[model samples]
Target: MKKVLMAIVVISILITAPLIYNRAKIEWNNDTYEMIVPYEEIRELAIRGLDTDTIVKTLYDNGVRGISFEPTGIQDLVKQGLVMTLTKSDLFSMLQKEDENTRESILYSRENGLYVLLRNDLDDRWENAIVKSFGDRIDKVTDLPIFKGESIYFIKGISKEELTRGMGAVANPILTRPIGFDENLMTEFASYGFEPVFRIGNNINENNEYVLDQMKQLQDKLGGHKIIFTGNTMLGVAPHKDLKTEDAEQYALRLVNEGFVLMPIEFTKQDGLNIYAKQFNNKIVRLHSLDFFDGRGGYTDRATRAVKERNIRGLYVHVADIKKLEEETITAEQSFEVATQELEAITSQMADKHQPGIAQSYDLLQASKWMTIAGLVGVAAFIGLAALMVSEKIALLTFAGMLLVAAGYIVTGATMFLQAASLVVSIVAATWAAISGEYINSKKDMVFKFLKGAFLALIGVWFVMSLLYGNQFLVKIEEFRGVKLLFILPIVLTFLHVIRDHVKDLAMTVVRNYYLVIVAVIAAGLMILVVRSGNDAGEMVSGTELVLRQKLEDFLFVRPRTKEFLIGYPLLVLGMYIIYQGKGWEQRIGKYLLAGGAIGFLSTVNTFTHLHIPIYLSLLRTVYGFVFGALLGLVLIFLYRLAKKYWPMIQERL
Candidate 1:
């Protein structure tokens, strides 16, 4: 019975597990609504360069049919007549001319069964108190309303066709107006069959006015319509009163189910623009305004000359329009297009300023591939030859072989591409050293002990460098030269001392000082020269007017220095350490000399530039190297003792 119950429980969990695991299933609106509204015409109203996808998405989210289009190329479309203009009859003029109770009218006109949108605002009393401020351009004055008494005047003329054309315009200036207003005005607009699209408060502090106004009016409109409310800034006058924090979703939900066409506008932001079209189950149509300059100069030239090209549908002014713009007060439409072109030019320039880091890395990899291949072949040949020599000398030679393998790692900057080769070299070298050291002891065969020592040394190199440079050295070749190579040198030197068995021999004294001085001088000189040259080359190549030489210098010498120090320092330390610890007491003679060389190299880096890393990482690298070196020493001693113990078994295997 218990078994049966357990099986049942398991089956139940299996059946429900997927449902619980896959939470938050995306809800989609499969209802396909025919886009009956002429969105292309509406898109032509805004600036041409506006992304049509943006506008279309915005409209569709608000349950606005085909009337939604990005304002990208609407301005240019207006000039081109691809988007229709509003006739006087096309005006949906809402006029409230009464004194106490307002009078209102919404004059809806259509051209061949197509809707046009044009909206104009007039106060209850036309304020001529001061000259109207319409920047710069002014021509003819046809109808001017004369203010009378204390009563407010009201006339909103909307050209449906012109608005549709404006919507389709490629580029245009932003159109802004006040938000939710008093109930009386709302009623007036509603009475005329015109939905209160947007309203403004009497003052900035009118909280919940937008929501309040909608709630009051929504009684008359719901169940099958859409309403869009757009907030321009953090300070909005609507349901924002209820929502203490800024969230677009809360505001959207307030109006989506209501039977009003929703449309909102907002500025570009980093998180990304809020698009509402998908909520209403509609796909957005992006429209872009093609600039005449960009179209004629950029696209045309690239298309003709380049191996790869793309077609563009953008806003471009005609040569005739360009001439017309200079002499006369061009149409507001024309002004909108000029503004769009300037914006596009600025956007394109900003985008071109940055190149991705991934691309730069790929370029470096392309250069490193051949270098890695050569290193692998060289290391492999050396290892195969050393293994075949099999004798007492071969065991001793293992220490020297390991050092050579470690040296290669330093030279190559410990690159990811070279890692495979480096690993193979390290393993082979370590094995030889372990087996050889054991044979030399002849009494205690401690091969395992020596193998541990070798392994530790290899690990020490990697850990020490990581502490010094972090993972940056792995990815950034510059860090390898600047920081890693410094560590690699010491490892190489220690290895050399170990192979020669200098502790019991007199030959060590002479060999020690000579190699130390040479290494120190080379390291110091390389560091100083490379840094100084790097600075000079950077200045000469980067800031110069001469392009060809500058480009050549950058590709050849300048860029490589970026990686040199990062790769170099670690290799130097590894090389020096391997040499120092490998031969025991006799190798101590060279320690001071190697130290001086490291100091010299460090001095060069310090004097030239403030490129030294943080103090903490440097200290960490130092501690790691010292600890690792000590561990390796202990292991090497153990292996020597162990090999002597197991001499007979080791000799038979050898």
Candidate 2:
């Protein structure tokens, strides 16, 4: 009963804790940052293009309840049913509450799921907020020639003739897919306080299903009321060719039906591109005149006022049979509420990955590494390990001698280590320690012990070298590269210390005979070349039919999949079998093989953990890796047994 109560309490906290504690999502945008509630707080919406009425009702009909009318309050709806939205009243009510983070409201959308914009809201009112933003920079361009018409236009630097001539030649935002206007005027328009919008297609036939479908595809990429591009004639060369009214009407209807608001161009003909948009029983806004930046016309204040009054949305436009607007579409009074709550997400992700100011563009310079003192760390650990295997006094004396030599090389320097020199010296020391420990502890022949230790020490050297930026694996750990040292070194070193048993004579004999050494040198060299070149060999060795790692990466077994299955799984399975079935030295060697195999699986798993890879793809890769790897192992095991049986019969015949 106590366990059940504890379970219930945990589940309840999971369910209701969000309501008790809520924080607004802040994201990096422009040069500054903004909370998802929108910086402007004017016509800015907590979420754009959401149709809450039908969604709540449908959910309630299906027996989901405890949701209230407002986004926050005592009877409020929860964000993802985890974090509860709180009001100012809710904050004051918690008089004991002190953390400022929990007091902020939250915004959420059902369709987009935890939507947050990393950019500023820009001016929805368009009262020169953009002009004010770039006080001096605005002076660099010529003044906008204001034209008052059915719509108003600010065309100064760019002439209207340019609009007439260039629309077709220059790419339309529609052809651009994101389908809205901002070309050449994004910073300027944004300065005027206009929402940043991508220009989708400009030559959309409202009547054409294919054209409408294209519009829909773009709309889905950016949720809700993002700006769109629409024009009557070939975008620039226009005497205002009108699309068929029926076609215009259908285009408008379909977009609304599909739950998107139209951001049609102003003065679009054939019913003026008015979209009568209603999605899931909620009205959407359409913003117009975004193309004015690209030398298209704008609207008069009266027309702009009318557009605002009708609750149109744009950052620019197509118009077709709009209205049935529920209200004036102001952020303050309308149904679109930006409140605290609905920001419930995995707190860990929110803390680590979704915090504001982390959304800046990353370049190679941003990823540039400083020289790490990792060689010293490796050196210290190597000395410590050596001390355990030998006498502490002897190990310390040797380490002191190496450090004195290193210090001599760095005379007058503040630090005692040089990056390249220290790396080489550290590798030499680690190799000596690792090999010496193995050589002394094992009763195997001197040559085999030396060979085994030498091979083992290569791993340590690679690990120390991984401190260099060039050695880090770009994506997967399963790749045969220096990155494997990060995990492999520690595990192997641990077992060598703890599970020191008889060494495998057969494996040692192979390595000592120089045959395996030659093969391994060739294989290891090829692998190094592959990694050092970033797997793009076309630069170094070019010709038709000459395979590049980039090209090889596309095939199943040849790329990541092959690395995981053929190399990783086989080692894992074979190692496990040997550990279980083989005695003495074979078991010890099996541990090493198993460790190697594990690297493959882990690297592949790490590849999938990156949020960029789709969950389905990750799943597919994992399944393929395991299944194919097991089959390969079974085949190898079968072959080994077959050979063993046949060999005994042949020996008897001989």
Candidate 3:
């Protein structure tokens, strides 16, 4: 009775301590930095070969957060000094109203000190039209295409197709506004050697289905470098009360699922923008426009305010009228200072907002095919070792083996890759140490007993570290409350074996009465309810990410991490008969596996209690593990009885 009580007390401590330690050790992180600036601003600074800090500081100071003007032939114009004229539609309208020809328009632009950049959706006959109307030479924009002639210089971003063949293009891909054909036109353009830097999908329709479909198709074809934007997606009025954040979040998740990797700024006043910033900070580049040389300085202040308020990661600036911007007294130096100061402020705030939450642990098994196999094999070896009685010397060797393997994994930098293997090692060592410590206690050898208990305690520490932080020594806070039956089952079973002699009669009486089977089944049902309650809950391997684990269960007719249900519980029942029914290896092995049912019961219910896993799914998984495992256990028990009866005939034949 004393031994049984001691075993229970020690097991109780062993099970809860690691979980508490792991929970206490978790760390959570929520810090991100993102922004944009103009192409010319980034280029001019880079070309000047300024110090990197100076460049970053200058860009940030100037409010250059997100879209840096992509370096291309535009720098050549920047060298001649940039002056903006009317937009394409406005320019064409003015030409029609004034009856001015292309040459006269170019000449008028030059007189205003503007560099005329032609926006050509202009038909292929533009050269002939210009020649007929203005009697001027029209140049073909080719690879190595240069225009020194004071006429209208065409300024579309040169594609990679042009650059690879000794031609110069803008560093960015051109914006392709597909006509009525939509993304199909984009496909047509890509096939014909047009590479868009980013795609803009017009999503202002009654339902955004067409826009969403086009974006998905474009992302699939265009690849990673090209980002697709949902231009005015849900373009209704903002202050955000009208715009649902949930709707925007769904749209964002859908875009990511479909592989659109970046986002541009839309309506900023909406809290939905913050949702986007939180959800897609790394995946999407959300921009706040500073509008550096625009006529209104009012836009600049609002842009800064939005950056601070919404945690918007990047800033963009597009200046059309340099002359109009001068009236606001916004100098290049002043803008640079403002951007740098704002960026510095954002950085400072990011540092403060950081809290020591749960440390993150990545799944080591999910990374590679080879590592996956290694983990599964490790589990097999661990179960094999844990199923038998071994000497104290063998237990010490097991302890040393875990240390050696962990050391090897660390040196090879494969700790994360061998996470499951490391976990098995730690568990086996801890289990053996615990059982050995109890043996020493029975002998009343105080000094040796203390030493064994100390070793067990040390192994317990290693178990927590290996299971919680993993190989990378990082703890993801979400793991704090997660249950790991991997450690709990084996070690608890080991201690149960140490108490078997003391609890034998009581165990056999229950088994002989046929009550153990009933208890195991009832326990399975009750555990399902405990799984619904947070504090008392166990665990199950739930969630969609456990892809391979689920696959193995489907293929093998046994669930992964469910050995306790199928193997452990049935062995417990079988062992009860074997202990008194037979002698030799069968009896001894039965003694070793007698705790399987108890361990199995734990395996079923706890598998569902994984912190983030849904309760309904967890219940279904637990029930399946229990029923299947119980059925298999019955088969093994029947087989063992048959083998025992046939042993005399088999011996005579041999």
Candidate 4:
């Protein structure tokens, strides 16, 4: 049975090795990234007296490669004097004395509502867009006399207050409905050698065909293919009908077929974005954008780290200090200077690894269905082998049950089931490795024990990578669930395994004051570990630690996690040395240390779970951690030996 399991494992590895290599090749080739600035922000700078041409030229020279353009809406049209709105009272007052019949007809049609009037110079497309965006809420009223030679369009279900407030509101669902793209703005930026990055806004009552048609037309006009959706949903999302799932899939299919690459923003919640991007088949780039107000000061450092560390290819640079500009604290030129300096700082540091250009989607090689089945079999066999160390009966039962589950997953292809199974595999493998260490009689024995644990953990890592590898995971549209659990489970399991035969002794030790204090300290450390285990760790990490991390990344190219190298692995090695000493206190303390050492195995597995990171970088980081941790363990062993040699004499002299 063991031989059969071993053969299954070997075959699975052979099948998955090629898939891993292909993923690595795709990631390595996706090195180019774009430094994009919003066109509205640039237009704001131009409004403040800076020349538009000069600002574009300066930004381009400093590695800004793309200009993001959001579709124009009624609010923008009002601001540009292309459209006007008035209350019924205001409209009646504007009517000439000779236009009594028109006024009487308007009063008969509607008693109260805001009326929208387009400029006479504008074309019919503008009216068509307003009708399409607002639908039945907007009514064309030729019965009323033309105002300033433009036709009257009466708006329903909107009060004057709502219209005024909604117009100035950011990302308002109704007021920010797409009217059309500003073709002249797109042409201006494209003339200055900037790739256009389009932002799509959701309209709850949107005409799906019109929205899709507009997107296709804009793509044709600008000759740029990248798109990012704005607001809380995608272009066709309808919350009233609850059509997000259906809308997302349909829009995704249309967008992909249209040859438009989706760019999902990092750290932002957009409903249906995950479903939408999944349809692109690895033809998407992850984007990182900073808030215009919140990111004013440290934009450069944050953006630099994003591109260098996170595989973020689209750097959405929001350099304008909108708050200061609104407060009149700085001149527009000063803001422009700050923007240029920020861009230069970020681009200069990243020039060696990345070039400024439009980021292209990765054409990743697809793993075959047979390879996935083989991987699942390998994971089951490996888990069974680990169980064999504890009990043959348990091993056989676990293998059969796991095979049954894998078969069900293959038939159904349920993502939740796959994620749960992968988490269980990770916990079991890490816990098994953590308990595999025995009495370490010599330095070579200690080293071998540590290496063996790491190897076991790595096998778990491989199993997980094969199971969850896909474009969705690669761009973080889907992530490994239960990360905090993955960090905590092995520690708990290892502790239970170590204390299984010592419950009475543990209860006695628990009552001791020093032991209670030590337990409290360990609990505190575990709490910190749980808090710092996710993508949002930056919020909890300290400034001093962040600076240290930056220095390490600079020096090592890929920084090893501090917990793995500095604390977990070294403590594990020291624990084994204590177990070898064969003293009463050593036996009692060594068990606790061994349980703590399980953290190293869990951490090793967690490193590979960050699917967005390149595989080669994770491997480099693990190797660095191993080497550094072994050296630290040797130092701890030397200190133990020196204390043992001199402690008795020193105690007698005292």
Candidate 5:
């Protein structure tokens, strides 16, 4: 019983192995910094093609995650969910509430999964009042210190776009906030998994004994919490020269060495070595594009060359930018909502456009490589197996067909037509030889076998005709080079089986008259080529961008109909039809003929992109092809009926 149970468990493990193997997960390592980029915000930047590096910095400063927003409250009248907004009335009410309820509100705010911002610069006496609102539940704020404001002054009467423009301004209210370090906030932050951030003036001495004293005290209490240095370092200058800069870097380096993270909050682009990389040599990881958050275009500083060369992490945007959007007299919640929606739309669009196609292209290339190797092995095995299973004549033919297919594939990078033609030829030959060998031994049902052969012969003749004509047309088109061996050849063999049968039985009367047919087609093709050449006499010119001139140059000198098309046409049509067509395959056969004729006509018509064709001439060319195809179809029908009428009498003598 124990053995049985162990066996079942092993079987289950085997079944589930593939699912585990293929699961997608985020890859992280010490060498490769894994910054969790908020994808949605990044896309807005991409659409505008703005600076990417600044976008990343803004996101990190704001503590923004790529998560969707949850509704904050229900609208009273409309009964719809509303996002949290900043308003004087709400701030006043929340502040006026007892400390218990205020704390309760803050905890509840987080409980509902929405970010809670403590209204700012209210007096310390009011802090007790705010604390009374929550009672003992102050510890319930999970995942961070309560974001506080030193001075809670609202910008008066400004359009949201104008405020967005002011995000980079020195006069921005966000810049003037007083610095305060709270030990209580730090304790509470550790309990709730939030790192306490202190805002200090950019000019604060890095080596200041007071700041070091405060950091050591906090480190001792919290066991190691990051101190966020918030200030703008002057652009295009050495941060080391500034006393405050040296202190900030020293503090960050010491903390980082001692298992603490130092995050500097800078409003502008300046060198601070928060994140260092070989690609971005000597530059600090800080927000850039301090110009403005126009909402239309985001600020990004990612290198374009970098994007092309390496995998990108993601993008970020400032939460203040989202909030500033609401200062347009609209609620802050509504502003965040709009920004969130915009972010989602942009990210979705970018992912849809780029990911799917790139993935498919990659997968196809991989499959092609594996499939080619597997096919070669399969061919070799089949040849060996056939030599043992069949007569030398049939096995040799099969082997020859396989070799041709392999050669074609090697030369052209594809063997679809060659492989298909080989298969058809092998099957038809094997069947014919087996039946003929049986009849010669037994002398039974020879007439029936002969009839089948005659049918096959007819099929082969049709296949040959189509292959030749199609190749003639295909070779004329510049794009049809490698396509012939892989596609056109096999297609011809598919239809040639009927002719093969006729040849096997010696019932083909068409071969006796094949010379006459070939001569007639050659004559017609020559006349058409001459007429096409004559039409281009004056239109063709050297150094011209005209389509006719370019085509004439090609047709006259390089890859002319006489050399390539004439030889390729017969093989192409015959091979293509034999492979692609089925019994009662008139429609399939017709399509092949039509495609060839269409190419022939289209080749002569000028298709220069820069050179515009006159509307009248274009219309004339369209009508000319239509009339030509119709006439040609009619003439072929007449020839087929003529052949059918005399085929029986001529076959009797043969």
Candidate 6:
């Protein structure tokens, strides 16, 4: 039975080798990223008497690769004094010596309705967009022959208070409705060799057909479909109902088919983004931005780390505060100089690994059904082998049950089941390795035991990685669940296993020792471990520790986890030495120490569960952890020997 299980593991590994290779190739090819700044920021500089062409050229020379452009709206036109809005009463008061026909036509419209007057300088696209957006609620007042050459329309079912004072009125209502992309502005940027990142707005009330048509026209004009959607929802998505399930799927399909890649901002909430990205086959880049007005420092370091460590491809930079520039407290030249220096610092830090260019979606490998099934079978085999360490009966029962579960999951194709099974396999593997080292007598024996445990834990890593393989996992649309459990469960299981044969003796020993003190210390340690498990655990990290982490990252390129190399691995070795070689009180405490060593195995497996990190980087981090941990463990053993040799003389003097 054991031979059969081993064979299944080997075959599964062979079957999934292609997936590993494809993932590596995709990550290797995606080595370029883009630095994008809002077009409005550049326009603000232009408004301050800085030449637009010179600003663009200067930014381009300093690692700026793209300019993000949001479409102009009626509110913007009003603010710029290119369009005028008036109530019917206001318009009636403005007109003097009008023809009777024009007067009669004006009287026919709603008395309280709002009228919009478009100047000749405005683009005709605005008129078309307004018509499409409002449909029957808006009417062209062409009956007035006296105002024939002027563009004027009356909007119905809207009050002045609703237009001016309603919540989000300026951003989401009819007045602030986006017309379309500014083609001339886009053309200017393209002429200066900037990739235009279209920032899609969701303020307009339009049907799906018109929304898709507008997107198609923009794509035709810009020649690319790199979209960064603004607001809480996506284009064509309704505000009240959100996007209907079918509509979202249809829109996602159309966009993907048209080669539109969405760049969702990291750490921000956007409705339906995950579903849309999943439908796009997860072929999207992640964008990172820090608010320049927040007054926090270290923007360059964070941006560089985003590119180097988190697979972030788009760095959305906020170069200058628009309000600050408008207030004249800061000059355009000063803002430009500051932005240039920051860009240079970021680019210089990342020059060794990435180059500034247009960010593209990764062409990742799609997992085949057979490969997924094989991965599950391998995980079941690993679980069975770990169970075999206890007894043949338990091993056989576990193998059969896990195989049946894998078969059922294959039939049902449930993702949650796969994640749960992977988590169980990881816990089992870590626990089994933690207790595998027994009768350790020499340094050679200790090293061999550690390597054996590491090898078994690595097998668990492979199984977890293969079972959860997909583009969704790669981009973090789907994550490996139960991370806190992954950190805690293995240690708990190891504790139970180490004490199973001596529970009565352990109870007595604990009562005789400083029972409350030990419990308090263990509880505190567990709390810290739990607090420091996830991606958002940066808040819990101390400033000194963060500096140390940065220094390690700079020196190693891929920093080894502190838990694995510094604390967990060394304690594991010390525990093994004391339990096997020491006499008296050391033997009693050694069991707990050995159980605590499970953290090392747990951390080794945990490293691979971060699916968004590149496989090569994870592998490098694991190697560094093991080498440094082993050396640290040996140093700990030397300290133990030195203390043992001098303890008797010191105690006699006392």
Best by lDDT: 6
lDDT of each residue in 1-654, candidate 5, tens digit only = 224423432443344333222211111110121122223234334334445455544443333222111111111101111212333334434554456556555435432111223334434533342233223433323332232423222222322234455376333232222222345534643464323333333433322224445656666676543333334542112456543444444545554454433332222333543221111221122211221245444222221111111122222233324334334454434434454444444333332112210000000001233334334433433443334335656655655665566566667754354335333433332233222212211113333432343233222222211111211121111112222232232223333433343455444344558868875985575444334332113422335434443363334321122211332222223223322332344433433332233232223222210011222223334334333433444455556557758999999989
Worst ten-residue run, lDDT, model 6?
A: 203-212
Best by TM-score: 6
All candidates in order of TM-score, best leading = 6, 4, 3, 2, 5, 1
Residue pairs clashing in model 4 are none
As for TM-score, the candidate ahead, 2 or 5, is 2
Candidates by lDDT, descending order: 6, 4, 3, 2, 5, 1
The list of candidate 6 runs beyond 4 A from truth reads 87-113, 142-149, 157-172, 204-211, 236-243, 327-329, 510-513, 649-654
Name model 1 segments beyond 4 Å from true: 1-174, 177-654
Candidate 2 lDDT score at position 512: 53
Q: Quote the lDDT for 419 in model 3.
A: 52
Taking all chains together, the TM-score of candidate 6 against the true structure is 0.92
lDDT of 6 by residue, 1-654 (tens): 788889999998889888888887888789999999998888788888888878888789878888998767666778778888877556666565787656656666464557888898877777787677777778887755546799898877565655566465343355655666677778878878888887866553443146556666767776657888887777555456643656667777888887788998888888778668867988899999965555887787788788877778999998788888888888988887788788888888883778998898888758888898898888888888888878988988888888887887788987887788788888887887788764577768888888888888888888888888877887777888888998899889888877787788766763645777878999999889888887556547788988899898888887898888997888888888887787656765666776777888888888888888888888899888888887888799899899999999999999
> What digit string (tens of lDDT, one per residue) describes model 2 on residues 1-654?
224423432343344223212211100111211111112221122233434343323222322211101011111112213223222243234533444433332111111111111112322322132223223322221211221121111211322233336455553111122212222333332333233333333343322224345435533543223334433422222244453444444545555566553333334542233233211122222233321112333222322222212222222211111121224433222322212111121111121212221111111110112222333334434444444455667656755654554454345432224333333333333334233322222323423432344333433333233332110111111123233342344335534543555345433664455867866874674455344332222334445423443354334322345555776566555555555566676566656564445444444533332322222334456566666776787686677668757998999999
lDDT of 5 at 355: 27
State the displacement of the C-alpha of residue 280, model 2, in Å, after optimal TM-score superposition.
28
List, in order, the clash count of every candidate structure.
153, 51, 52, 0, 64, 0
Clashing pairs in 6: none
Q: How many backbone clashes does candidate 5 have?
A: 64
State, as a TM-score between 0 and 1, how close model 1 is to the true structure.
0.22
Return the TM-score for each candidate structure. Answer: 0.22, 0.28, 0.29, 0.91, 0.25, 0.92
C-alpha lDDT score of every prediction, in listed order: 0.32, 0.34, 0.41, 0.79, 0.32, 0.79
